[model samples]
Target chain A: MLNIVILGAGNVATHLFKAFETSESAKVIQVYNHRLESLSFFKNKTEVCNNINNLKDADLYLICLKDDVIEDYASQLKYKNTMIAHTSGSFPLLQNIEQSGVFYPLQSFSKFAELDYKNIPFCLESNTKSGIQLLKKLAKEVSKQVFEIDSKQRQTLHLAAVFVNNFSNHLYTIAEDICKKEDIPFDILKALILETANKIQTQSPKLAQTGPAVRQDFKTIDRHLSQISDEQIRRIYQLFTNSIIKKYE
Target chain B: MLNIVILGAGNVATHLFKAFETSESAKVIQVYNHRLESLSFFKNKTEVCNNINNLKDADLYLICLKDDVIEDYASQLKYKNTMIAHTSGSFPLLQNIEQSGVFYPLQSFSKFAELDYKNIPFCLESNTKSGIQLLKKLAKEVSKQVFEIDSKQRQTLHLAAVFVNNFSNHLYTIAEDICKKEDIPFDILKALILETANKIQTQSPKLAQTGPAVRQDFKTIDRHLSQISDEQIRRIYQLFTNSIIKKYE
Candidate 1:
């Protein structure tokens, strides 16, 4: 079994901890957080450390902190030649460290939801060839797809992910808001949501686009806008519609 | 089998034809299109007609024309009180014809892609009680969820669908464009896309949202924007990021 130590207790950290716990080939040797309360959940299976000095020696160290604090955390941990990894998409592999990499799971994680990692793509990157191979082997235990992506590619993927996932969910928020304001049942729009996602899986977004905006049907667009009283939603509808029309043409 | 005559040979018409063909309770008896060439696909199973005068008698006449031409086509149909219906989300029950209603499948249709209607939601509305019952029965054959939604509610749902599906998809298109320009593979973002959808299914979109934009991380946002060379994409990213930040705050 691979010896692993997870740092931080945020969503990504919690998810990684639980996922590794379930994996046959990996075992959490230790858990570390700046605060003792954050490491409380992993108290039974592994040793929890609040003090930086008490950080145990492990084969691999996975840093699951926010992007801004990754560098600081890496500098504080003085383990030489240890295979260190961060789970942030935007941050690059640490250059100052002798052996460092990224283990970015390209998915939205929540504490409540049970994540199925079978289809979840793991983007792995390391400075050393053996480190990459080891990371790839660990990734293979959970995920069907794994890529040895550099920091630049991961950044681009993260940006694209923001557009497809984050921005898309925001649009769903806008839709839910509109439905609530109009006193329409939100369930009425559920199937359409699933269909839209399925369509993208088969066809390109350019070919799959529909609505008054794509047709340039100003009358229908005006009618739709007139129904909504929210200024932000109206502006969003107009701006996005215009953007789509411009992009496709 | 319930004999059904479909009017118009557009995307909706073709989709309905394929759906009804698989439906055990219903069979398409005839198809009417302004141009006879469009009716070629349904020739074996349906009696194709270009002229309304040649329209055959059927249990139901489904008008599947565009919103602009629906009224015009509805006015020309010789058949009346034969469970006539229009496939539109915005159009009201036709008061001009007896037993007229709507059979709106609340999803986008594409000719190239095969649609699985088992989970697709269908919104049914009719002027008469019997018409509503028949439409509900017909819808139940193809979908698990069927609701009696009036034109007002459907219009609201349609508007919301535009936000959730159309606008959300435009965001995906933008992200894809950005990724393409940056030489990033679009599949890298698929895991995020699937997870985002799954997240919204359980939690509110507001709670499920995550990104540099939502967190108002100007440092990363500026960094991402600087990397993009396309003027249009940069503008879109900036505008959307600003909107998301504003919404969250």
Candidate 2:
């Protein structure tokens, strides 16, 4: 079994620790966090450590910290020859370490839901060939899809994800707000959410776009804008609708 | 069985006609379109006619025309007491017609793919009691979720849907374009898309929102925006990111 130690006890850390513990080929040797409360979740399966210096020797050290704290954590680690990796989409593979790479599971993790890593795609990158092979093997234990991506490519994918997922969810929130204000049931809008996402799976989103904005029906657009009392929502509507029309034309 | 005559032969017309044909209680008696080519799809199933005057007797007449053509088609139809309805999210229930309502299946339809309307929500609205009953029955035949929404409410929902479905899909298109330009596989972005949608279903999107813009991490935002060469995409990124920050504050 491959010995593993997880640092940082945030959402990503918790998820990775749990996934490793459940995998038959992997064993969690230790878990570390600055706060004792954060490490409580891994009490039974692995040795939990509050001090970074207490980090035990393991075959692999996975740094699942926040993007801002990653460099600091890397600088403080005393372990050497341990295959070190980070679970960040934006952070580059650490070149200073002998065996460094990335183990980013490209999916959102929440403490409540049990993530089926089999469906989640893991983007693996490393500075050395051996590191890549080791990380790839570990990734296959959890995910069906594995990709070897460079830092530049991973960063591009991260930016694109923000537009597709984060911004898209915000749009749903805007729609929910509008429905609430007008006393329309929000469930009426739920059916379209899945359908919209499914459409782009088969065809380019440009071909799938519909509504008055694409049709460039200014009269209808004006009428719809007038119905919203919130100035921010109206502004968003006008700006996004204008953007879509301009892009298509 | 309820006799239904479907007017227009666009995506909505074809989808609705096919869905209605599968219903045990409903049978399409006629299909009408001003263009002969549009009626070719219904040639085998119903009495396809290019002339509006050729409309036969039916319990309901559904005007599945485009939003702009809805008014024109309503004016041309001579039928009265035949319960006329239009399948549009933005268009209000026809006030000019003697028996009018809306049978808007609140999901995007494409001719190339088969959509299961069983889970798709249908928003039903009508001026008369008999019209409402007819629409409710028809909606029940295909969809499990049905809402009695008025024209004013539907107008708000449609606008909201534009933000959530149409505009959001446009954002996805923009992201895909950026990925293509950078030589990054769009598949890497799919996990983000699915997770983002899943996040909104559990929590308010405002709480789930994350990115360089929301966090005020100008360093990363600047880096991402600088890499994007398209003026239109950069403008959209700026507008949406600004809107998100403004909403949170």
Q: How do all models score by TM-score?
A: 0.94, 0.95
- Candidate 2 on A127-171: residue-level lDDT in tens? 889889989989988778899888888888887877887678778
DockQ of 1: 0.70
Q: What does candidate 1's lDDT look like per residue over A73-184, in tens digits?
A: 8887746468899999899888788888899999888777888878788999999998998899888887887888889888888878877887788888888887787677
True-structure lDDT of candidate 2: 0.82
TM-score of chain A of each: 0.94, 0.93
lDDT: worst 10-residue window of model 1 chain A: A182-191
List residue ranges in candidate 2 displaced over 4 A.
none
Residue A203 miss distance in model 1 (angstroms): 2.8
Docking class of 2: medium
- CAPRI level of candidate 1: medium
What local lDDT score does residue A199 receive in model 1, on the 0 to 100 scale? 75
Task: Quote the positional error of residue B1 for candidate 1 in Å.
Answer: 5.3
Clashes of 2: 0
Q: For each candidate, what is the lDDT? A: 0.83, 0.82
Using lDDT, give the best candidate's number: 1
